[model samples]
Target chain A: MALHFDPADLAARRQAACAAVAARGLDALLVFRQESLYYLTGFDTFGYVYFQVLVLRADGRMTLLTRAPDLRQAHRTSVIEDVRVWTDADGATPEAALRDILAEHGLADGRLGVEWHAYGLTAAVGQRLAAALEGVAVLEDASDLVSRLRLVKSPAEIAYTRRAAHLADDALDAALTEIRPGAFEGDILAAMHGAIYRGGGDDPANEFVIGSGPDALLCRYHSGRRHLDAQDQLTLEWAGVYRHYHAAMMRTIPVGRALPGHREMLDVTAEAMAACLDAMRPGNTCGDVFAAHARVIDAAGRRAGRLNACGYAMGTTFAPNWMDWPMLYAGNPVVLESGMVFFLHMILYDDDAGLAMCPGQSALVTDAGGESLSRHPVTLTVAV
Target chain B: MALHFDPADLAARRQAACAAVAARGLDALLVFRQESLYYLTGFDTFGYVYFQVLVLRADGRMTLLTRAPDLRQAHRTSVIEDVRVWTDADGATPEAALRDILAEHGLADGRLGVEWHAYGLTAAVGQRLAAALEGVAVLEDASDLVSRLRLVKSPAEIAYTRRAAHLADDALDAALTEIRPGAFEGDILAAMHGAIYRGGGDDPANEFVIGSGPDALLCRYHSGRRHLDAQDQLTLEWAGVYRHYHAAMMRTIPVGRALPGHREMLDVTAEAMAACLDAMRPGNTCGDVFAAHARVIDAAGRRAGRLNACGYAMGTTFAPNWMDWPMLYAGNPVVLESGMVFFLHMILYDDDAGLAMCPGQSALVTDAGGESLSRHPVTLTVAV
Candidate 1:
């Protein structure tokens, strides 16, 4: 078995989850999020795109219902002993199978917590699930039950996160060498990913956000790759993943030459990032971190370039993104806690000046303050 | 604009979708699948991970409601003129905003088609949407409407798929050089991805499946990568993505030496793959393709070694996987059509012999037969 966590650690995690379930007055929790499944059982696979669920009872017994492809996968990667497979065929109702599993596990007519917000449970399937279990059980929405527990990292998780941070730094260093004028965005992106993989890192949960020239102002990953001009801006947001734990960083580099607006925006971004990190200490709410960022950026007269959210929590995430719950946006009540990881990015898109500056890095929340996860300094990177 | 399709092509696609909506007796179709959004408007972003939706009316009018980050993105990449941003805030209800948008567009109390099977619509959000729009609109599940249209590729889409096939070939050629004895799976995977990106290919929708040694018997991607021993087997399933169109291929190679069982399994896999591809003509059903694979593998007494499904349709896909609709499985009944692409892999995992062999390639269904997309031949690849 290729379990990522120690058996003892997994047991502790599962016990914690069961405690959470008991506290919520639920007999069992239906695990739908892939992250939650990985956390409790070390079961990992992209097979969650199908209808799969892991039932975790308050008594600590666990059962998994998944497709055939994941039968060997669950056995090999997860510690869960009771694995059930739902045969695939036309008009096959996995929801019915899941209902049967619930009944088999004494969950029928019992109050159960379900991860309703999970990507694994699509709307169509969720509807079917609801219909299949109607009047049989009381299903409560416990979307954040496991995620709240996962916000704080254990020692083993932190160690993997630190390794991911190192790999992120390596990726940036390798990309720096390939970011000179006339460089193709595709080549630089490839170099970054290659560096991570060469360091035994895993594929990130999402595409590395890459855009150049006029596209530099965009923070999202979009199609269409282009070559860097003699004087162009390139924005890149990428993560290094170790055992699915991610350490993300973002930077906008200037090619051949740095314009005056680029330097000004970079300074503003750096200051804002510093303010955000300073406010990321334990006892502070996630809103406080956003306030610090907004204050710095708005005080610098760059409100137009600022975004509504400065950053978000980061951890073991699956496809679609590395962003975890408790996003650092205005008025969010999620409190910062030790061992929490966050990617604090200060993005500035100066549309009027036609310049962009984004400087950001991941940090681990400590009792004292936020500790930098990345070794790269926050400064103007002019790729000459 | 960095639209992947020409304006006329996009307009035609929108028109076809509108026609589908009218045929379904709906006033508008709510597109939650990113593939459908990209197919109609060329607005590409992983932002679909959020509650983003595009409303296409039966009259061909279109509108998008997304988060703030994608404001500029939708404008720059899509032809839709009506892009609405939903502010991010604590207790923010984007579903309410969507309802208001629908009211403003005169869709209130109208029959609306919803893509309930989309990854974009999580169970939680879907429930919220249903509640918010209750009695406001009659929502119908129209998940397969757009997908059915996407099954047949346009000339432009086929061109991109052809380029992706070339990239897949390049990736395999690069990996072959790095798959010798003592090679790390990470290094080989990196080489394959680097080759694709260096050739200007986009990221695959999911992680490229790479496994060696005992793991070669498994088909899905799993954590914990290992190195190849002096005499070992490696299985890889990867795709080349160009402008979001994918052409996937799979191969299992032997390192240093090929065992007798490996050669035997390879022959069985190759013969099954050939039979499957031959059954992929325009008039044949997807079930027929699977039947061909089953006949070849079962006749060789490899029933225990073969999987229930042989292959699946391949095309524009997002995170989680490249497998599209109309999976080649038993009793699928979906008929093959010209211009539809499919990835056919014949896998044989012999636990008794501790050997595995899988060889597959993407093909475009034609009037005469299935045309191979990959240039690589199916054979036993031994890296010495």
Candidate 2:
């Protein structure tokens, strides 16, 4: 059977979103991004990828304004959607469209919660809208109101995530067998992606950042034309989607022989990961999880760990909706709740030796305990 | 070798974009999308999938305002790129970010041109920007400026597109041989995607839309549990990308004995597609190209002939680019340049026999003629 959001369930989610906006004291919530729009109404068509904005008022009514093509497609996929199409005619401008949607929705005035982080909302649209709507106060930092709502994993979301986890595991296993000496960095990436695709992986978030040798320290480094060598640390941070839920897993392998320093780094990373999970419970503050990892690493005498943070919240799919709350950083004061998901990664950048790779597993947090979500083994594997 | 764009090349493209804006507009041009940014600075990274805006002024000076982390990544990839970091403290709000960037660049009180047709120039950002930069004239439709600059492909870009075209052809060929009765639609899609992945296809924008039986008419319909019988029509639309260059190809096939009406409909589609290709030239209007397909379908006397508006202008990559201008719409008046690329798709929806299929191909406009990018034959293949 095909996977689709039930029309009735969509209405319920919209209502939840509306209530959140009102609770945050927003007269109208200004949604100017794709993830927020898709999260609200399940509109995942190509046309929705524009600077379209939907204003969901406190009164429970909503209106959207976008280009004509997306308007037609948005109507088709959305369970409850209203559109104001903009073309060359009728003074095609974002300001005009924003003005029309606001006036029609009776949101011409009052406090507006804005996603200040989104692009496409130009200074021009802002100027025209302020003049058209008197007393439109903008609210900042309401991301929690929205992010919290999407944090808890639903049953369907978990099922898809589990599949994503399985694909990640399979990709890594393929990498272990294929990441050999004399192989170009691209060959290992190709084999890993091939495994993911065959396992029914969804659109991968990005390309494989396969770093073999000194390049492993710069995790963001693109897989260059470097050959695998003996005693080199191969750090891979790859994830895939199954249906839309994403699973991110990191694995570090010694290409041929394991040096004592590399083996010790992996050991410390594993210990830190386990300690963080030990503090992960329903009522614990997010800081405790961070402290747990930090304490474990500190006790192990590896003070300069690569990661200084905790995990993030997971959701229905990848990229947009699959986000993690930075509980450790930014003083995020939310308690770790049941049904949350995060990736626990540990690293230590040795300024002298470059990036010391020893990051651990990805997992899904439950009220009972933390469940592992990686296919790679916890221990370091020494290649023959 | 890694792809690169020298600082002089960046200067030339920026000058070209600025000239197009001056010819079409009356003020400062705001480049608010990732694709336009990539077009200008050659900042090739996966971060374009997120919220970032690059402003190209009429005077050829540019300012890119994006997330702090993204700013770092952009700088590492491209040598000619310049970026301003925006974080939660420094104008984290869309309006605040727009206001700060505009004020910094000294465009707080001028007419701001925007690429609103694509990307997120979010309404929320627009509304917020209105308050900060008062009395600014906001105009729409600067996408033409970017599109005009992008319409013609470069030599290196064409080489990448050729590679992508071959990948798409190979995937389609693999899928054709695997089509058999009693095969699950899901399993076949998995297999087709597998072939694409093993062939080193693009991680982003490479989507395979496969539909079987009565579900084939949706054009964008994903395959389902619908069993493939001797009477079913299997339709597929798949593309391959190289360094952001894309070439898409689509085809339809019959499982075994084709229905008499199905074979007739397929023949009409194939003929219509071929006729449209033969009509292409260096200087044809987009509307005229679309009209040619309509005439061929009308001559066939088939009421439900090729229904889509053919395809739009194709570029170095695929969608969300202003480069492939003079799209094949009902009333577009842009002319096809010598280096412009286009895709001609003849799709037929036959209700009587419950069959739908497209014979699609891409072409690059040349001095002598438009050359076909795909190597696949357009005739319907019977799978027995």
Candidate 3:
């Protein structure tokens, strides 16, 4: 198998997932999220764009129903034994095939947990599944069942995150080295990603968020390339991925001499980041982290420029986003635990000044506090 | 605005969308798909990971409901003047905010179209939306309303695709030039992506499908990297993106001497691809293209080695996938239309032979026939 872990480790993960399913009074769990599937059975593929389902029983049995193309994919990448192929013929219903699998496993009349909040299970697919099993079974929206279980990381997973963090540091170094007054934003991005791949990183979960000038105030990737001016601001938010695990980082760099306001904003952002890190220990709530960030910014008279959340939990994820659940927003009740990965960005954008100062890093939650995975200094760097 | 098109073009697109909404007898259309939202108003951001929606009224008025971070993003990238920000407070319900928007627009007592088949609208979110709008409005599943309109590309969209196709050819050339007997797959991928970015290409919707040696028998990208063997086979399927428009290409390369089976498979793949391209005309159905592919493969006695679908539609799309609507599968009745972009991949994998010969390219459907976008030769390349 193409799995990084041993078969025993994969089995233990599946066992834990089954226990979670049984605790929730679900006889069978329909896993839809690609991250959750990879965590449980090592079933890695982009075939989730098509209709594919992994059914895990309370008795520790698992079955994968997928299209013909993914049959070999599942065989090579996952430990799923009972694989079934769903044809793409006209009037073909993979949902019915799923129903048959449930019937064969004696789970037709039992409660089924479906991942209704996942990327793969759209509303139309959910409606079709409900219509197919209306008279035969009961479906419950257990969307967060597997996600919450995956919030805390294991030692092995943490190792992967640390490696990814190192790669991210290398990527940033490459970007800093390539940045100049006349450098194109696209060229810098290319250098950063090239360093990441050379350092043995996988594909990132989202596009690298890079922009310059006024576009730097906006935190998304646009199409065209722009040449940096003599005194310009470039904002970059990217991740280093290892085995689908992400260690995200963000930085705003000045091309030439730094403006006084820009330097002040950077100092404030660093102070807020420190405060957030201090609050990210075991037994503290996610709200506590946000409160710390807010308190630091408010005390510095930058409350108006602060955002609601300062960070979010991160782990194995798919594209369209790398930010995971249990966001550090106000009054979020999720308690921090040891071995949790979090990305904290103290983003302070002064629209009037037309400048942004966002400095962020990924850290691992420990007994004392959050230990930063990235070793890069938080001080603002000016590219000369 | 950061939009590629002028304000008038955006206005005209919104007018067409409003006409469609009125024709369907809907008071307002809630668009959650990133592609549809981008096509309508040029509001491009990955912030859709949060709850964001574009509400288009039947009377040509539009409002964007998004988070605070994306407010400036909307103003900078889109022509949207009416923007609402949803708070991330403890008990903040964005769906209720959506309900309020509908109520303010007099759409509380009318039929509304919801894109239930989209990536953003998960089942749980849809259920929440239904509960929020219950007893006030009728929520109809009009998922295909906007997607069908996007099937036929505009002249401007096709221009972007053509540019993207040229970049794909350049990327392929870079990949071939870098591939050697001892080179790591990761480094090769880095070179290709670096070339794409340097050539002014955007991030692709899907991860580049790349593998070598035994891994070449598998399709999707895996985590680990492997060194190329002297007689190894490497398969690559990647796309060049420009302004979210994708032009995909695929190839199977031999590291050293080409085996007899490899050469035979490549010949058959090229013949099948030529036939498929010949069948892709404006008046033909998608099934006709599939028939041509099947005819060539079956004549070679390699019918069992082929996949179900040869190609799919392509256009402006976001992550998780680039394959668009109107897939070229057997018995599919989607009529080929002028100004449509299609990616046809002739994939043939023989597990017993431990070999694969996949040759593919993107094309534009014209009144006479399909015009190949990629100028790369279909013949197999040996990188010795």
Candidate 4:
């Protein structure tokens, strides 16, 4: 079974992670974040909801502890050779099994880095694992260690993100073609997702945010599907996911004729987005990009409608969300490095007008500036 | 904004939850699980990935603390009146905001119930929250308090599940029609998802597990869509979710004619599923159903191929997974009750032959036995 990445690439990632652990004075690292695990070993599985842990020793030994169902999955997807399965039977303690694995690796009394902020490591599981390792090992919080390493993408990862961007553009085109007065939101969503899948894109970490009319004012996937009203607003926030690498896009479309405040909102949002993109240079900080967004919106006297953060980092993320670290918020000092992917969304919601105008695009940070990954125009799409 | 259910229905659910919290001697319940929040207040949003908390006081006061993006979302979808938005500004402390909310509710010195096992509460966030409440209040792990109440479905919820089942049947039909030699797995998946949306179903809590060839042996959704071989096995496990209510279905299909071992495996899986369904009576324990599944598979000398748990309780759930509590495992003393839904999958993976046969169905427990929710046939689907 071949891995998702080249063996050499995966090995380099593992070596870098091991070096980071050693530099941090940790003997071993217990990784629970699915993205970190995939980045290190190419192990891609949704079985992390259950008790699954990857023990990466600084000496280059790696072990995966998972359930029986994912045994073959890890074998096929990951390059890790040492794998163990823990039973879900009565009185079965996976924490104990983890302890035994640590003992076998001769790291029972060593300092271990744990991902406390990871979605894979819940409070209950963390508490149980802490109890199991108490008196045997000292657990240190190293949640952002691998995440920071993944901030910059490799050429292969950037290629996947670029492909995902193309798919997102195609999906947006399909959605625009399907949007019409009296068209059901579900049908429009079907068209967008259908185009994505037909383009060979994988499922996104989160559901696409799509709604019509008043529902568009809200940025969530609510229960019921509404029919598009003539001269109504439709908000769409979707991502094209390829190998868990997401390139997100958000655009608010006019169902028929543009409303009174629609054109103004669109123009301001596009200008703000362009400024944010322009500020995403190699040396600029995330806060600098947010400042650019604020300057444009504030100059237009639309600061009340603009969001605090214009964008965030995007990468190979798991479910529950697609948003990554180093968010483009005020006072965030994270430097923008080349090869980093970002989704800059200029979201402005006017409560008085009951209107929402969000024009967003995904881009790759280059030494020169931000290169647009999505080819779709920033103008407000009008479905005639 | 009208809810999916009646106002009275949502009120009753909140009342029940409040009673449960009071019974546990908790002054207030801090709900984080998306399913629990939705069950109690119809607060449906994917924004739970960020820091969001719902405070439900036993004295009938309710408050929701979330980010700016979800303020309108909570108002439109839920009945919660007092909604507070925490800023993402520099030096913004959401924990402080949460602490203030607790103080305002007079729960500062009270025992508060927290969902420590929930995905909404990461270990880092949980730790910060505990630190914020330290010396001011006591935090108790009441993760399963509301989940246990949601085990039994209301009539309105069951109605939604039945509708979702209908959509699942339609989706399966679409998938079967699209499956053939040389067909792309992505296209088949597209067809199924498109059918589901057109049938007015919502996005499922988890990605549909669809794979072919050796990939079918793995339960998780891995990357790469395969072109079906002339002789290949394909597995599909999907659910049709309606207003968060889910009715799941799983089936294994042969691209061409059924192999020699395929029929035998299918027969054994179907028999095991039938036996498990028969044992799902109102008074029987979850283990009793698992025992029946074990007996059937063990008698066939295929016990090693089967999983420890035959099925699990299912209902409204969020992303990352769809499987719910009270799993049908050996020695689990959770008793079956009327209105409880279960998805019994007789998964048999014969790695030696590289063959996987899983026939599953979702059902509702009744006085008469398990009533099938998914109308799809529990037999091997052969696409010739």
Per-candidate TM-scores read 0.99, 0.79, 0.98, 0.99
The candidate scoring highest on lDDT is 1
- What does candidate 3 score on TM? 0.98
What lDDT tens digits, residue by residue, belong to model 3 across residues B80-167? 8999998787778999999889988998898998888777777777778788989989989888888888999888999899999988
Model 2 vs. true fold: TM = 0.79
* Cα lDDT tens digits for candidate 4, B57-101: 998799999998898889899999999998787667788999999
Off by over 4 Å in 3: none
Q: Score the docking of each candidate (DockQ).
A: 0.76, 0.18, 0.70, 0.72
DockQ of 3: 0.70
> Model 1, stretches more than 4 Å misplaced?
none
Candidate 1 local lDDT, B1-384, one digit each (tens): 688778999999999999889998999999999889889999988898889999888998888999988988888788989998887789989899999989988999899999998887999999999999999999999999989999999889999999999999999999998999999888888899999889888889888888888878777777777878999999999999898889999998989999999899888888888887788898889999999999988899888733567888888898866788978888899998999999998878888777889898999999878899999989888999
Could you tell me which residue pairs clash in candidate 1? none
Give the DockQ-based CAPRI class for model 1. Answer: medium
| lDDT values for all models | 0.90, 0.62, 0.87, 0.88
What's the CA error at residue A356 for candidate 2, in Å? 5.5
Question: Residue pairs in steric clash, candidate 3?
Answer: none
Superposed by TM-score, candidate 1 places the C-alpha of residue A211 at a distance from the truth, in angstroms, of 0.4
Q: Write the per-residue lDDT of candidate 3 for residues A179-276, one digit (tens) a residue.
A: 98988888898899998887768888788888889988877776778889989989999998888899999999988878998999998999999898
For the candidates in turn, chain A alone yields TM-scores of: 0.99, 0.87, 0.98, 0.98
Scored against the true structure, residue A67 in model 1 reaches a CA lDDT of 85
Q: After superposition, how far is residue A239 of candidate 1 from its true place, in Å?
A: 0.2
DockQ leader: 1
